[model samples]
Target: MASVSVSFPKYMSHIPTRHAGHLAELCIVPRNLSLMKQGSVRELRIVRSSNQTEPLIDCTNKPSDIPLLSCSEATERLKQNREKHKGKQQFLAMYSSIYGGTVTDAAAMAIPMDDHMVHRGHGVFDTAATMNGYLYELEQHFDRIIRSASMAKIVLPFDRETIRRILLQTVSASKCIKGSLRYWISAGPGDFQLSPSGCNQPALYAIVIEDQSLFDSKGIKVVTSSIPIKPPQFATTKSVNYPPNVLSKMEAEEKGAYAAIWLDEDGFVAEGPNMNVAFVTKEKELLMPNFDKILSGCTAKRFLTLAEGLMTAGKLHGIRVDNVSVEEGKRADEMMLIGSGILVRPVVQ
Candidate 1:
């Protein structure tokens, strides 16, 4: 392979280059550099250059070198990157057992890369909504996470009361009156191996995200997902392994739908990608699929308990939790998806 001649300014000459084929490309390894394309050539601009200048070079190969960064430099770069994209949801606070405290800076809100949760997906998570400065059904959600961690064979980092207190304190620090709190329990940072035996300890992490959006009452459309449903054991646990769920959600959005519903191996209605399904029959009876093969959503269970009042008020004839066939669900008078995040969302299609 012939060497591709490329010239940079005196200050930028340190950047290494490489060659592939007739098609030329420039590969910059630093995250702080900005790429600008003009006509057929691309230019690299140093974001924090002392002279505040960009390099105009005719590049034909990718760079084999990567810049080694110090801990503070990397953290600053991450903070800069986050400043570029400000979304509607704001991360107000974070709590990490690894740090043994809480951090209000969004840049400091991160988990270790070696964590089993980040690598082998050996983690479980739960979410609670903050309503009017209070965590709604936090105890129920906390109980579910505990069950999930036990099923995943992850020991808690702290006792139940301790963890609960940490969660509340983290939320209070955020001062977010209305938002959501999400937390995770992982096997902690360890070697890149299949077994969690190398993990010295378990980890817990929590973050509070502020959402100003109101509860949307508009009904949405849904379709049957082509992705296979998770097995009963894994399905029931709210673990971090969610490739199937992610794919199902993407499949629905690709077809212009809000969400995709799943069916069990026996063809009974299972649940949505992340929510439970419930229906109101023509006889004014409330019906839902059994939780034997799917996750029992905290919000769905709470709704079922509260629905008894509707029965007493003559709004519902009865409530049943059994196998709901697809045909039966389709024939129902109304259908809704239930979960902590959504609370309850009606499905019009």
Candidate 2:
């Protein structure tokens, strides 16, 4: 029979002064042996109390020793572990200013794990594309995110001007002329509770991701989404709760389609998973679904504004925003999905 002994740091054996009479329990098991194996197992349990002497349990087996790691050694081990996945790090650069702190290393950008947004999905986000060092629709997207944050009850960590500068600085730091800048504003870190009352403040994080896919005007195909459309409240806000959107996109890919279009409960065509859908009728009239129960897309709005020129040039007869039935969309002369990521992709089916 093997003997076993258990030990702990002297500091852990002492009870906190605040909890003078409380008891502490510690259990130690052999690291090298499988607990499930058919062997008589013995564990050392330590009990500490202010008024009682520490008690130790002796077992048949000799104690298996465990080495404690130093802080530097632990940090090196973490770095080595992260280096193993260096190839999978996709962001070109990132910038974060949590709790009004200045921006730090892009490579080490991170949000607090305990942030309310991380666990409760109480956050809003937005993305804008950078073209030739210019952030397309940056102000528009920023405004939208601000509105979304208000709807989510998240206070801004910084004012509008400061946030704008941070975004621009992050993009410049990335040094990518053509990429996308995505950012989030989250309710700050605190106790892991259901309510935001425990949060200390709010946080803002931004990252620049390389998207080299060139614009392709070629028509693609899409199917109506099997995923249900979000209600009007959630649909209008660009929050981080995107499980439905992700599932819808996955559904499209599984069906061998470019994207999926969502329809409202009433069966009116709403929008694509991450874009706005537009249709051109045989009469050369452009029709887009109303934004009442869908995200008001910046790129889609820009496209509509630009398409007005086509109307003036007689390239299109008219433009209208109203409810679009699925049958009407299916029979339109042309259909398109418009968004910042894709610009404008015509739909063949």
Candidate 3:
């Protein structure tokens, strides 16, 4: 078979850093069908532009007058391109794609366009962080994702042990001592239909992101969420349907607060947009909202387990999980938000 490889310029700087590389790959792939139709295999590569202000180049079509490039020429071009742009690349360090059971470079990673998660949001996702070469609470987060997948009616692509190995391998491949691992299990790629029955099996994707931002411990202000909270069924599932949560977060940012807190249907304290809330009561009690109507947070659960030592040491009188009314929470001596990302953040108001 004939082979053709093309280079694209850096048009990705304008896109948000998280999604720029993926979108750049998508934009380049569709326009190269003519070469493929000629029984030629094509590879599209992106390289940074020398002039920062100039619009980046994208390889689309080879002019008929120009001769087809040889394999060595293509390889050399890619090498030179990488050498020129290596310092500026902020793409994923590594990613695992379950469809092919392959771990790949982040720039070369792309999900199937027709996955149910892409079209209908039929998926579940969970994240764990790697700090100093250690994966924090990985098993706990994986269990939560499995529960979410069950709730979403999505079967896993691999057994739990295999998945755990793959995740650990993915992180090891990245060699990211301080980064976060985010993974998803989705109803696999199929026709873009509402029903996932047409899909053959589920898909898993994991990526290692190098985020160096330190978790802030300082107190932050939070506003009451105006967006309606999801019902207990959906709220507790941790599925991919997160429009309500997204809106709640945006509402908080728009109101000049760090995050917004949701209240259950009965006006009891529910959770932050994406975290579990806890309170330190005046009676030296540690209180968390009951998990019945909120997502059961692994970090919060671990905190509760460790806080038992506090009680034994006389630092706390008791620890209780119960329905906490908004008024009661507001009157607590201290309030905090807990999550994998934010280990603990005091809520000032």
Output the number of the TM-score-best candidate. 1
Error of 1 at 297 (Å): 0.2
Model 1 agreement with the true structure over 1-349: per-residue lDDT tens digits: 2223434445654545443211123433434434443433354433344345445564545653678999999889889988998887999999999999999989899998999999999999999999899999999999999999999999999999999999999999999998999999999998889999998799999999999877887899999999999999999999999999999999999999999999999999999999999999999999999999999899999999999999999999999999999999999999999987688899998
Q: Comparing candidate 1 with candidate 3, which one achieves the higher TM-score? A: 1
Deviation (Å) of 62 in candidate 1? 9.5
lDDT tens readout by residue for model 3, 220-327 = 999999999999989988788999999999999999899999999999999998999999999989999999999999999999999999999999999999999988
Residue-by-residue lDDT tens digits, candidate 2, 156-229 = 99999999998888888787778889999998888799999999888898888777766789989899898989
Against the hidden reference, what TM-scores do the models get?
Answer: 0.82, 0.77, 0.74
Error of 2 at 43 (Å): 12
Superposition error at 259 for model 3 (Å)? 0.7
The Cα error of candidate 3 at residue 98, in Å, is 4.9
Model 2 Cα RMSD, 1 decimal = 9.5
Per TM-score, what order, best first? 1, 2, 3
Report lDDT per candidate: 0.89, 0.82, 0.81
Residue 97, candidate 3: alpha-carbon lDDT: 55
What TM-score does structure 2 among the candidates reach? 0.77
| 2 or 3, greater by TM-score | 2
Q: Candidate 3: what lDDT?
A: 0.81
Between prediction 1 and prediction 2, the one with superior lDDT is: 1
- The top-ranked prediction according to lDDT is 1
